[model samples]
Target: MSKVVLITGASSGIGKSIAVFLVQKGYKVYGTSRSPKNIENYPFELIALNVLEIATIEKAIDFIIAKEGKLDVLVNNAGMGITGPVEDTPTVEMKAVFNTNFFGAIDVMKMVLPQMRKQKSGFIINVTSIAAYMGLPYRGLYSASKGALELVTEATSMEVKKFGIQVVAIAPGDFATNIAAGRYHTPVFENSAYKENYQLNLDVMDAHVDSGMHPDEMAKAVYSIINVTKPKIHYKVGDFMQKFSIVLKRVLPDRVYEKLLMNHYKM
Candidate 1:
């Protein structure tokens, strides 16, 4: 039987791209949106699942299990982005982003694990960000949320490996997606100390996404990871420099790396 796959946040962007690609590859794909309705022309089915809502998560997982008998893979890709100076960004907003990007993904995994455990075979792919490897100016909260998920991915992999469930994280650099529209942007208050710098980085961030790699590249990476016999705990998909930044963080002096990031963002 073809693999049964469920991808969260699949209405558009990277999630949608992965869903479409997997469908073409002959997997039974079920993509999700918070409100899936009246959408069409897709080979895979779209279900209702909001990572922030436990009921929706449970419903979606149960629906897939009831129909497919067993879910073979889950792409935990439903996440929101936030960008603002850490001090100026509302504490509540930071918590909300973490709730979605971090706790929300964990909730979905928790709901899906029992079923996978019973089957003794499954793959869980947590969609993270290359930004997770290092904190970036104006995008610190976004980085922290995804970074937290990356750690959880590692711990979960070791915890579940004995049960035949494979868990891994795939961190992608900027990709051409509608993520910018969904992100919560703290306004560039005229009087705020970070106003000018924040505005500059906002433009920089948008430009990066506008010119970033196509989502198809990430889809292909996910497909490859799915087919591997023993996938690594973490994988990154991005341009040479984006991926290399992680390595630089490891080898470069703390202040040196800080200077590089500051210069990159023109801080």
Candidate 2:
């Protein structure tokens, strides 16, 4: 019997790539998106879903359960990025980021766990980012959101291990995806706090992401993990610099690591 996999944020980038790859591997892939029509003629079924919408999330899951009878894998890949100084970022904007990136994943997990428990087998992969481990200049909000997700995945993995469900996080370094272009930026008050460093931080973050790794690589990494018999709790995927960044942070002193990042961003 073919395994059924559900992936959120399937309209583009890594999600789209994974959906296509899984379909090719003979999995029954149900890819969810806010606008399924925009991704017409895809290999898998595209279900309309907006992760922030509770009703839509429930409906989408129910639809899949009715059609497939079992959900073997759930990839929580939907998220947004907010780039600006943390102090200057609006509370509303920060909430929006968490709503989609953190709470959205948690909601989906809660909805799917009952089914997975009954089935006695399933995998939940949360697509986090390298930012989860390291803070960037203007990406504090985005980083914090992903950081929260990392902790969630850590605990969820242990909680569900006895039930034969695997929960893992994939932290991909800078990926050349719509996320960078799709990032929301709000104006900071020139006279407000952190003004002196706000624009500088924003520019640095923009340049770094613009030159990040390609999304297809991240998709490939996701595909690899889904097949593992005992997948690691977390997998880091990115270019040399990203991998190095992780290592440097561990070995170097806090101030030294900060200096390296500052130099890398030319701040």
lDDT of 2 by residue, 1-267 (tens): 999999999988889888998888889999998878855579888999898888998999999999889999999999998977777778999999999999999999998999999999999999999889988777888889999999999999999999999999999887666676777886767786766566777666667678877777877888889999989998999888778788888999999999988786556
Model 1 per-residue lDDT tens digits across residues 20-74: 9999999999999999876776678998898998999999999999998999999
lDDT of 2: 0.88
Q: TM-scores for all candidates?
A: 0.99, 0.94
Q: Report the Cα RMSD per candidate.
A: 0.7, 1.7
